[model samples]
Target: MKAVVNERYGPPDILDIREIATPEPKAGEILIKVHATTVGRTDACALRAHPFFVRPYTGLLRPKRTVLGLDFAGTVKAVGTDVMKFAQGDRVFGLTPGGYGAHAEYVCLPADGTVSAMPSGKRFHEVVVCEGAWYADTYLKKFNLESGHRILIYGASGAIGTSALQLSKIYGAEVTAVVSTSHLDLARRLGADRVVDYTDEDFTKISESFDFVLDAVGKTSFFRCRPLLKPEGVFAATDLGPWWQNVILAIWSSLTGTGRVVFPTPRSNRSFIEFLSARIELGEFRAVIDRKYPLRDIADAYRYVETEQKAGIVVIEVVPEDVC
Candidate 1:
């Protein structure tokens, strides 16, 4: 099997294509013939080991996992003896933790882990974004978003941002999205009730306030968007927080008034996957594909995502010959 292997973390260039033996499913895992996968911002972050804070878990000096990819959409080539839910040819999509080998032609994951059957009539790219969207949904649910609520999504053009926008709308919140000029149309198409071009205008300068303000890109600080929140509104950012920071924020928010600053940490689960599948099948959500790269071209895909100009998901077509 051909795989994109990374011996160390630095830049996209560190990734190299190499031939490796195919993996077999473990007792509780299933081996997937990857048809498609995505190179998301998280993948890039893990690649560069940026922020220097995540290194403790990702790796001390180098990445623990040689292959780097988080989300995958593929068909089951083989299943472990204990896995009765998935047969040999079920189409599925989901997230993997340290087992980030989706960039390869095949990946093995626990059948019960974040993995789920691809909803009928749903495409691979559409489900590729489900894991990230599940995270966004989890965080928004934490903030108690409800119908008739007004919410603002910063960085609405990125994968997480776009997913947040669509999920918020489906949850019945009136959404206002902030994006770059090039992504205005993309944001609008994602169902944002209103779009703000952050390049031309500062969202903070606007008079409107929201029940929830989510900074998908982590570019805006909680303080910067405080005024945009309603009296009891909540503000959330996707940037990973230190363990102590998460504890402090949780404690502070419990005793504070008017607003709270929160860092969202999404836990992947089956229910979330089921929800995403239903929405995608109903056409309530859509995945945006900025570009598709071959397995060996994973490096170039990472470069494109790091630019922060990508409209949506950047998929890596593992089986390019099978892609339509």
Candidate 2:
């Protein structure tokens, strides 16, 4: 099997595609011939070990796992002993949250982990979307977002941002998406009740207030968005803000019982994958893909995503759709 290997953390240039031995499923696991995957913010962060704090979990001296991809969409090649939920040739899409080896042509995941069957009528490349939606779900879960409640999503054009905007609508929240001028129409098309062009005008100056103000791209801070929140409204961010203020504020908020600032840590689990699968099968949710690259050109894909300008998921087709 060929895989994207990054022995040490650095830039996209550090990545190399090398032939590696295929993995076999362990007890209660499934071996997948990965057909498609993605390069997103999480992959970028893990690749570079950004923020300097994730080192302990990823690796203090070096990357714990060289194959760095979180999302995988493929077909089951084999199942381990006692695995009954999946069979050979079953199309699937899910996250490799624990070991982070989805970049390979073949990878193994626990049968009861984040893995799930592909939504009906969806292609392998189309469903390599769990990473973004999984992170977006953290906010919706934290806020306990409800129908009729209003929510605002900042940086509404990126993978996490796009998914957050769409999921908020599915959860019955009236959503206001804040994006640059170029993504205005994209935001509105994703079901944002209102779209704010941050380049043309200041989103903070808008007259609307929200039950939840989420920084999906980690480019904004809570203090800057505080005024837009209702008295009891919550402010959440996907990243630790500048100087790690979001984490600090989250602890303070939790200790003081203010419930003001929250730092959501994305969890990968089968329950969430199932949740997304249902919505996708119902045709109420979809992943926003910006572009795709062949497995051989994944280094270019990483370069593109690191530019920080991609509007949505950057897909890597490990196995061409025609072949799949």
Which prediction has the highest lDDT against the true structure?
2
Can you write out model 2's per-residue Cα lDDT over 1-324, one digit (the tens) per residue? 899999999998989999988998899999999999999888888899986888999999899989988899898999999999999999898998564998999999889988899998998888888888888888889999999999999999998899999899998999999999999999988999999988898899899889999998888899899999999999999888778899999999999999898886776678888888889989888888899999989989989998989997999999987887
Please give the lDDT score at residue 209 for candidate 2: 89
Q: Candidate 1 — which pairs collide?
A: none
Q: How would you encode candidate 1's per-residue C-alpha lDDT over 98-176 as one tens digit per residue?
A: 6388888899988888888998987676678865587688778888888999999999887888889999999999999
TM-score of each: 0.93, 0.98
- Worst window of 10 by summed lDDT in candidate 2: 262-271
Off by over 4 Å in 2: none
Error of 2 at 167 (Å): 0.7
All models, RMSD in angstroms = 2.3, 1.1
Which stretches of model 1 miss by more than 4 angstroms? Answer: 240-251, 254-259, 321-324
